[model samples]
Target chain A: MSPSERHNVTVHGPADGQPMMFAHGFGCDQAMWRFVWPAFSDEYRVVLFDHVGYGGSDAAAFDRHRHATLDGYAADVLAICDELALDDVVFVGHSVSAMIGVLAAAARPERFARLVLVGPSPRYLDDEGYVGGFSEEDIADLLESLESNYLGWSSTMAPVIMGNPERPELARELTNSFCRTDPEIAAAFARATFLADNRQDLERVRTPALVLQASDDAIAPRPVGEFVHDRLPDSRLVLLSATGHCPNLSAPEETVAAIKTYLAR
Target chain B: MTIPAALLDESAEDLFETAPCGYLTTAVDGRFLRVNRTFEEMAGREREDLLGKRRFQDLLTVGGRIYHETHLAPLLRMQGSVREIAVDLVRPDGSRLPALVNSVLRYDEAGRPAVIRTTVFDATDRRRYEQELLHARRREQEVALELQRSLLAGALTEGEGLELGVAYHPADKGLEVGGDWYDAFWLVPEETIAVVVGDVVGRGLAAAATMGQLRSALRALASTGFEPGALLEALSEFSRRHELGQMATVAYAEIDVRLGLMRYACAGHPPPVVVEPAKPARLASDGRSPPLDAYSFWTDRPDASLQLPPGGMVVFYSDGLIERSDRPLQAGLDELLASVDELRDARPDTVASSLAQAAAGTTGSPDDVCVLALRRRPART
Candidate 1:
């Protein structure tokens, strides 16, 4: 499970530098992370790997329950630690895995030095006195979309969610890979994720956290970004003026610079 | 009978050309948008011939035209999108095409209605597969539910003196149904009625079938005129003879209203409770018997009896009623008694509902349970 074996880990400068792990979003494997890693790997032991079911990883290891929520993914991060035997790691997770690092860091506070949650969501749906920006019905529609023609839905919906029509092919390809991940596993994960109320877990995160949000991200809007920053005790909010879900793909130089500055701070 | 390769190739081309799918797009107001080359071919018209001039509703067969104007159009207008929506489409020659269509709201840069992009899957093959899958699921549920419905509830014979009300609730957790059964029928001639409550381990169809077998034996053996002690021992032997896999918790009681005595047998079953006006009520008879299974290996104990003295309600419950995770069974039983006390003099049905709520309070999930309440009526002069 070491980042070196399965994932495309391109180190720009030093391998023995401080360790930082790069987690990819759904529909993408480690490659979704490639553009940003080259800039960060120079100053750190940059780690990257495909999630259990995606990319070059063994597909049989993926199951309905295992990848259903973030716990199993957090466990994968931990397994990477035990395999690489790295210590005092800086965890960087994107999309679903971003919140996963938050959980893992919260659960085992000692393993992580700091959390740089890129486009994280503690909860997706808004409630009374709480704002996550989606309605119950909206969430239901999203789930229905995922269930019906999951590949086409994700391919088509990613661009809509990202609001970057210029990268329609990118959105389609990302979604196609995302949809290729076992649907049953993804659906169960969707239930575990979209149905979860992790507001309590957010309050328990003690690590110094950084929230990197793309400016016009259809998925993670600005208010939700502010919400994550406000809830975290030791945190700062950095809004990249990028108009896509994965800013590392759309605006890598600014995203990399922001990450390097946040790590330095 | 020799078909040339060239002709076979032509047939394949025709098959592909006449494929069932007819792709189309429409404006938000349900006007004719764009039909694929195949779709225009299916309609026996040129693409230009069908474009712009036709409304989607107009292309529907007569029934479909009315259906879209009523149900489909209204819903899509309000809901913004509809999926797997079944409908029929009309061809230009006044023919109909059976299809399943899904549509979504497409908006212009002004966020106004732009066009509705629809992917219509020809339902002819898929409809059949989907129907078959649904039929199979329905059949499984039916067989399981039938087994649930027919298993022992209450057994009553003519001229019986005892009155019994029973409730059996399977765990609603959706895995498999546990086998919980009760019978309150009579023993003829002596004017005595027998009450039996038991839980067979495991669940689903097998446990249900085992329930049927055990309950039938209980009914047949009640007429043996033997004491409750001997009755259950014979029942255990009957279970052993059948080689039923799982064990059961059972209590069998014979009530004689005129005599006011209840002879009861316990096969590792929870003791029956009595709600009395005197002290905080207690379980009437506490005799114990081993569970009925091959590995039970315990010796038979004597049958116990108590006077169902006038105006008392005797409560017999299965083990699932008293089962709990952290609390002792006695504590769970106490909770049940307290809950029953809260709903004083509740009807048998109300009592069942209250008991169910009480059980829910113990754990997040429901376990199998069967409760039998037999009230002893006051005797006349």
Candidate 2:
């Protein structure tokens, strides 16, 4: 399949503006950036895409072997860049996508100009000397939760996750958007997201980067974010006051401001 | 009708406290603003502790919290209201309260999100029932797979100057086993061999059972020295008499190694492929008939014979091999022919395995595929 069809790429903003690509983390699709992407659309060519098997991307294009590891997702990023003929792009990745951006930049440094990682974590499981919040059992529990909830229940919980109880419409839109993903695909994505270790890939990213860490994130704690920043060669860390895994949904202003500052720098 | 003044004067606070369901209100970001007495009792938390200190999601389990962020919150933001969502709320004591929740977003005068009103209902029994149903579905899938495996287990006949290969792959999308089967067996020791491939209509256990019956019946009929067409005619009669194998398509071929002769017949199945030395592979489009039981009166089915020189191969396969949703059947057949042409001189096992792989592509197919290849080699001096 063509990259456009495989990734469900959507381009907005100006044609001549610098390209800004947003990759959503696990548990959601490109719609996770609804609040954050619009802030950049006025200045940059904002690009939003659903990973294959999520949102509007073609599920039939999902190959188990090709998507068995984070490298597969990195390949998709490269494919998107190549198909659009994009160069010196600004890539914004949330959660696990942060590592995906790292791998993509490491593979083709010329395609990216800067990297913005929102709530990034190089490793999810606690290591010997590191303080990644969750344990192996916790990750297994998370996968079980994904399996139990399935896509059928996504409509019910999407609003709560989006944290916009006031604007139920936003929650409803997100529910419909993310719930369309196949449950098998979602489970596979969960396994790929939590079990991944990308600490080594962090050192290879040469692009100037920004790590936007949430102050009280349950998924990726402060120490994990700091660990990522310490490993990254040319990256700065900005701690947001938001208190969850998804600051983009809960604290869009803070998330947007951090990205803007990084891009300006 | 005059009502008692005391009954009419019940306080609003009393009504709110004694409501049937738990009720709460939260800020747009899920911070607790106000929770009713019923909600406090249901959640097992004091109102003073929850009012400003906790969000609705904080009361859920880790899994529920993830669901809250990923699906529930997003749905509520987009649709304004969500109903009948099951979540396990963690009580103060660390136990779980299985509950069904419904929440609605209320907007302020300026059209901005302001607050959320939610109701919680106990759903312990419902959740148990759903779990039971899920377990039963998985058990059924396991049983079907086991049945299919036992039916397909067997050994093929091998001898001098004769080679045979077979491949079978079930549909990858569904949990149920498919009804495609293949068999290769010796009819006359060191002289003649029979190869058959068939697809029974439908899926799951019934299709598999029907496939097994037809396969066994074909072997029994062929053992009586019946020709390919006569064996099919008998099999069709057997299907009608036993009320089994309806609408099944099959191809049967018997090859005589000593004389290098091959007789084949098709019943609404794709014609077998023939590959000769220094010649392009071609479909043996002869001795064709409708699928089993398609005709009320069983007639003598016609049979076609071909002169197979040394190193000649005949390939029989089910429809799934040349049937794809994206392309026409003729195109798939042409592709299969081309694949055969490329591997014409390869071993029979390689040809069968490679053709199956080519038909499946990178992503496995959604239907069962079965292929059987038999080759007649030069007779040993």
Leading candidate by TM-score: 2
Candidate 1 lDDT tens digits, B1-381: 899886577565565455466667787555576777567755666767767876666565533432343234433544456666555555677665556777777778986557887766655566567558757756776676688786653344434344456676666333467778877775645457787888888777888888888888878887877678777777788787778734687888888866777888788888887765454657755567777863545356578888777555677777777785446877877876776666536554566666754554333234677777776665655
A133-236 in candidate 1: lDDT tens per residue? Answer: 55666555444333333333343553352344234344434423332344444456556655666667788898998899877554567887888888888898
Best by lDDT: 2
| The best candidate in terms of DockQ | 2
The TM-scores of all predictions, comma-separated, are: 0.46, 0.87
True contacts kept of 1: 0.00
Q: Fraction of native Cα contacts kept in each candidate? A: 0.00, 0.20
In order, what lDDT does every prediction score? 0.66, 0.81
**Model 2 over residues A1-265: C-alpha lDDT tens digits?**
5787668799999998999999988866787888899999999999998787766666666656667788898899999999999898999999889899999999999999999998888888778887776677766766655655654435466335333423535534543455545666777777787788898989998999999998767678888999889999999999998777788876788899888877887
